[model samples]
Target: MERNFMTTTKPFVIIGAGIAGVHAAESLRNEGYEGRIVLIDRDTQLPYDRPPLSKEYMLGESSESNIYLRSHESFNTLRIELKLGVEIVSIDAEKQIAITSDGTIIEWEKLLFTTGSRLRQLQVKGSDLEEVHYLKTLSDANNIRSKLDNVQQVVIVGAGFIGAELASSLKKLGKEVTILERMPLPLAHILGEEMGEYFLHLHQSKGVNVITGDSVVQFDGTSQVEKVLTENGRVISCQAVIVGIGVIPNTLLSDEKLDVDRGYVVNEFGETSLPNVYAAGDCAMWPYRGANIHIEHWDHAVNHGKCVAKNMINEKSAPYSAIPYFWSDQYDHRLQYFGHTKDWKSTVLRGNIEDQQFTYFYLNESDIVEAALLVNQPKNALAVRRLVKQQHPVHTDLLSNPDMSLKKVHLRANEDKVSY
Candidate 1:
């Protein structure tokens, strides 16, 4: 397909106003795109940060006004039209127009889908109880926080990032928290059994009850959530319940006209299969290391928005090559992970794992760093990111040494100063 090089008066319509959509709009203005930008979302509130919804916001440490990504005046200064609480019912790629639910049609020269993802709700018995909640939006956090006073014994389902983070926050609030996971070890698939066991023990040592190899079969309550029943015939009494199993990409606007797999399939330039259209954030799966992968982290969304916005403006497209990065704060431990890899040949550990401060390096056959996990080791984060991005071989002996710095580990190939 040929690029739309001609600048038109029509608006550049963006479907969702989350991190990706907001950044895309800002990047468009910064990239000298003076055309009309329409940012739309079904949410009534201004675009807000989501990571805090389960952590600081739920703990009441962060205020509602602090969670917003941009001020109202900033949007006006950028000349970006904010269409909050409006849902785009349908769109015609052929006609280059979109129809809203309230019988409104919007014309556009280019369209970007930053629709993000929706929470994966538990569909079992009593899942619709009043006290049961899923933390995804600022409003969800508000709803959960409003009832925290009455919620003494809280049951958290799933031991993923959100669930673990919520457990940490609730435990800090003096709530008796119980986390139920179907897998034998929490986060074993993503962080491996060793690191997963560390997390299991970390939560357990912090007074949070971590139950593995069990699943919630039903939520029993009269009006609100009173207790939870597990598949192993274990009934746990709780005043409230929070479910955070996962999320599914919101690709409803695709309407079967665009290519869809795990998400909207896009190339390196963030261009969808359809012409004059693009997708980013959690809803778009772009090429990564010869595979199309969708990352649901905040860092990826910010960089993806910036990369795609440049492509939308320039006739020459560039590949999105930003390294995938994300961080989680559970109690005092800040877990930072860099790079993306599902498989590794061997894992190397630096510092003492039992001390709760360490870094784990996932290496391929060539001794090149594929990913690294830093547990409470903030000093090693930047160096680890560089090693993963450089993809250079390193000395394992030096890497495991506590005295050796990671910035110099890649230089060990030479005898004098080490290779740069």
Candidate 2:
């Protein structure tokens, strides 16, 4: 498709106002995009940070006020038309326009779909019972928190980050939390089975009742949820239930305009198959290395937004390449992971995890560190991130020594950057 018309100063429209969308809007203005910028989201609240919806905000350790991405004044100052509570039903790629739910026709020369992801709901019997909940928005979190006081026992389905964090939060609030996961161990698929066992340790030590390798088959109650039925015919009575199985890409509107393969297919520059129609964050499957990968990490969203924004304005697109990173907070433990394991074949253990402190490194066949994880060690997480960024081979003997400084990765970075 020809993008010759995209250079015009016509209005630019962004769908969804999550972290990726908000950052893209901010980046546009920062890159001297003085054109009319219209951002529409189904959410009424000014785009807010979502990570806290399952963490401190849900635990009452933090307030919703602190979770907002930007002040209302800033959006106004940037001349951004922030339209919330508006849903776009269809897109006309040929006409370069969008038809919203309320029959509003929005024309645009260029568009960005940062539609993000939505919760994959429970499809079991009696799943629609009142008191059974799913956390994806601030409103949902508020509803969950409002009922926490009266609820003593809660059943949480799935053991992903959201479920695990909520379980940790509820347990800290003096509520009994029973987590049910169909997988054998928590976070096994993402963090590896060995590290998955560590995640199990984190929640189990906190007194949260974790039931793995099983799923809730039914949420039973007359009106409000009072009991949960597992796939194995085990019955557990609880005052409420939280289903956090997973999420699906919110790409229904852009199906006709973009090629959908796992997610809206995008090049390394975040430009979709359609000219000037770019995608980023959770809804975009952008090229990494030689293949496309769909990432949902907060850091990836921020970086993708900034990179795509720059590419949108530049005459020549620059390939977006950045290592993925994300952190999880559970109880008193803070776990941080950097990079994805693909080329890596060997795992090196750094600290004594049995002693409640450790960092693991995933090394490729060439001995370059491909991924690093810091458990209960926030201070060293930055070092691992830098090591991944540098992509330099590590001296295994030194890296495995607990007494050796993690900062040694910096020296390796310097050596790798310099050519002989």
Candidate 3:
């Protein structure tokens, strides 16, 4: 079905030209909203995919051209007025207008805030050093890439996706890497402790110094980052420091009182407390179906963007109820995870770990709750996602059988036999 919006004379202003904002603009056109569309971004260039920056772009496998999400011609064809390098300073909800950094005011009937996020800063001694870096923006990536030659012993402050990926990337360049994570295991909270332990092994096997249960208290150096002092009083020497702790949503422009949690709180429809103003992307904290809690994921961001745009133009739109999904590429392994399994009681691993192709399914009692696959077994992920969504009761015998495919198992059984 064509998801087009009604053509109105007044322009629909969208802030931030990230993936979410770009998708929202395209979704507006696809919904038949042929009216004036304004896409404002603080970046001097057009919106680009950030995932490639740490992986392909850093390795020189992909160029800058491959990172561009939309071309100028595409925006021109869609009649989108691109406002690059203009920062939205503040928003007046009552007036339905936004003032830019240059004091230019623009009125809008509906506003979509896709301002995304910025990298969390580290406030400590030697944080202002020349070699200390935080990767978030394209410029930051460029700077990091340039310094790769001089970086010998790299200290990563967090063991999150960015930190892990950077460790793998720098390892490929023959750099000694040490990852310091406060959690007991890397990705322990997101992928659960057991699976996180497996990942720890994977990183250590690849010669990465995985340091957990430690936090960087301070950096001791003269003009550059020379040593990192942890909370445990252990000092580690490093030529460069890359802090990948986390990110904070950029929501300072919104003057209206919206529910702000760790991020900007929004309902299932990506609607904040304010009327006519919506949010999406990393800046948004929208609800997840399975977890029934607001989550921050790339998939959630894109989905929320489309949902918010559609609801802004249409009155009879459905609420955002998509499952949260995300993936990470580290070394040669492809990690794909779907749904939330924070409360899962049991986890089953399918396929051989030695073969490097397996799917880990997390179950709560008898219900399949979540699944994560390593390597490129997308079919298994799809089948498990369906079972999780339907809350189907998976048989222990069938799940344990290496010969029995998840697709066949799911399709052959009836709901009565599959129910918990």
Most TM-score-accurate candidate = 1
Candidate models: Cα lDDT each: 0.90, 0.85, 0.81
Q: Which ten-residue region of model 1 has the weakest summed lDDT?
A: 1-10
**lDDT by residue for model 3 (1-420), tens:** 222232334579999898899999999999988788999998997788898887888887888889999999999999999989988778788978777776777888888889888777888877898889888878888898898888899999999999999988888989999999999999888777877888899899999999999998899888888999999988999999899998888877766476777667777677777888888888887766533354556777788788888987884385887767888889988888877756778877778776778877777776555554445566677776776666656775677577997766676444556452
Write candidate 2's Cα lDDT for 167-189 as tens digits: 98898789989999999999878
Clashing pairs in 3: 3-30, 3-31, 4-30, 4-31, 4-32, 5-31, 5-32, 5-33
Which candidate do you rate higher for TM-score, 2 or 3? 2
Which ranking of candidates, highest TM-score first?
1, 2, 3
For each candidate in turn, the TM-score is: 0.95, 0.94, 0.92
How well does candidate 3 match the true structure, expressed as C-alpha RMSD? 4.7
The whole-model C-alpha lDDT of candidate 3 against the native structure comes to 0.81
Query: What is candidate 1's lDDT per residue for 143-221, written digit by digit as tens?
Result: 8888998879999999999999999999999999999999999988888999999999999999999899999999998
Best by lDDT: 1
Number of the candidate with higher lDDT, 1 or 3: 1
